[model samples]
Target: MRCETRLYNALNDRMRRSHGVAASQYEFLRYLRDHPDTRVGDLAAFFAIGVGATSKGMDRLEGRGLVRRVPDPADRRSSLLELTDTGTQLVHEADETFGAIGALIQTALDPARLHDAAQTLRQLLTALEHDRIGTPAG
Candidate 1:
């Protein structure tokens, strides 16, 4: 738990200082980039966050000219999210930033240990999500 918290804190601190974006915000942008016509409700569910929080992030992204909200043709009340050119650029920058961090860690740690740690973390996350959804793990 301490290790996870420290890693998250370090990542957040680096992201905020370097890109003025939090990890969750970056994730939201990435999702929009991948799914160009994604609905807001879908995004909220995908992120496992409340609709209000997702809406607020959308507003912030729109205010920064990174995302545009367009009304769905089929459903006038629902909106689809799409990334703008600036958003694309930011996403690329964020990817590069993360890549650099990965490279630094690779250089600092043993390759085998790092791989094992990553696998362990992945398993933990999967188990946690299963617990969150009240699913019994086999």
Candidate 2:
């Protein structure tokens, strides 16, 4: 917890300073860049957050002209999220900033240890998902 929080703080600060976007927001953008036409509930489920929180986050991004919510033809109550051109460009720049800051993590841990940690984390996440740790996004 201590190590992750410390690293997250540094990453967040640098991301905000360089891109006017928080690390959390950058993560959301990066995900959207890779997976377009995602719904808010889907994002909430993936991130293990509440649907309300996800919707609020989307609202902030939408207000920033970074993303837009399109009505889903298949689901009247659901909307698909997509990054705008500006959002795409911003994410591209932010990716560089993220990678540069992420070098510190690589420097701190050997590749083998890092790989082990990542695998452990993935296992933990899978366990949580199986157990349904958080409230459902609905």
Top-scoring candidate (TM-score): 2
Give stretches of model 2 more than 4 Å off.
Answer: 135-138
User: Model 2, clash count?
Assistant: 0
* Best of the candidates, lDDT: 2
lDDT of each: 0.81, 0.91
lDDT of 2 at 134: 74
Over all chains combined, what TM-score does candidate 2 have?
Answer: 0.91
| TM-scores for every predicted model | 0.78, 0.91
